[model samples]
Target: MNKKYIQCIGTFSIALPLLAAIILTGITSIVKAHLLGNFAESKNTYKTEQAQIAVLNELKIQHSKKQTQLKQWNQLLTGDSFTKVNERLRQSIADSNKTKTLQLTDAKRSTRPTYAVNAPRSACEFKLEGTFSEMQRCLTKLECRMPNLMINTMSLNSQINSNLLNLKLNYTIWENAQ
Candidate 1:
């Protein structure tokens, strides 16, 4: 009876450790599967973000170009009529201190409708005497005040002293055709 009891104890000890090892192996496999799934899902999310970033970058470039075009169109819509262009030009010249030395002449404008939109335009030619800096400032001011003024031609002649400059410019101003 003693030998039988010892044998039962040995068998119980061996079976207990084996069962525990089997349970541990099952748990390990389940944890490994869960970790692999999480890793795959993370990889997919990263790829999606990369695609979205690429699309956003493209949209940013197009948005800048469209914004510039919209600004130009808005200026065209808000620009002054033919009569105001001369005043704006004179004001710009005055601001640059070139009004006293400026010579303005009216150009031969076509009375017929030339534009597809039937927009009336006034063309004028002007000669200005000043330094390069003054001329640049004058141009800047004219552009700012009269957004729809288009300079068709510009010619510059420098004097012997190089400090004096003569600039001849041809410009056109667009007005809404009533």
Candidate 2:
């Protein structure tokens, strides 16, 4: 065989694999770029959209829970449209005070064995015949131990018959909605 022909055959042998590798690399690059483009678009459009929707759903859930809590607090702070919550609280406290713990001051209202709030709902008024110290302690307990209690008015007068003082106290209590 001629040396020139043999040299040409050797060159073709080396160039064949090199050409194949280049063509295959180009095809793979094109295929990867095509698939990556679609993936990137879906990740930005569909995946992000789904995540945003989920965030909105969570926000709505939390908003509703907060709204419910707000309504309950409102009910506690203000009982109904007609009557004030503090007035009702006062009546309930007065009723509770009317128990045997306190002696009646105004015999007319005290004659009844009931604690009442006159506003078709509640009020706070009670009479206690005792030393000033006892009444003060009771007021402190109401302000501290109880959740929401407001003392509206108090009248302390010395009794002639007894050395102790006569106390006419009025307070309020707030009942919160669950």
> To one decimal, what is the Cα RMSD in angstroms of model 1 from the true structure?
8.5
Residue ranges of candidate 1 with Cα displaced over 4 Å: 1-83, 98-118, 160-162
* Model 2 alpha-carbon miss at residue 28, Å: 25
Give candidates' CA RMSD values in order. 8.5, 11.0
Q: Candidate 2: deviation at residue 75, Å?
A: 14
- lDDT, candidate 2, 48-118, per-residue tens: 89999999999999999899777755665455421443343244345455333444444111121233643
**Model 2, residue 178: what's the lDDT?**
33
Candidate 2 error regions (>4 Å): 1-121
Task: Report the lDDT tens digits of candidate 1 across residue range 1-178.
Answer: 5998887887788877888999999999999999999999999999999999999999999999899777765656454544465666667777887445543434234233345565667666667777777778878987886677777778999878656787877776665554
How do all models score by TM-score? Answer: 0.44, 0.34
lDDT of each: 0.71, 0.59
Candidate 1 lDDT (Cα, whole model)?
A: 0.71
lDDT (C-alpha) at residue 13 in model 2: 82
List clashing residue pairs in candidate 1.
none
Q: lDDT of model 1 at residue 54?
A: 99
The clash number for model 1 is 0
Best by lDDT: 1
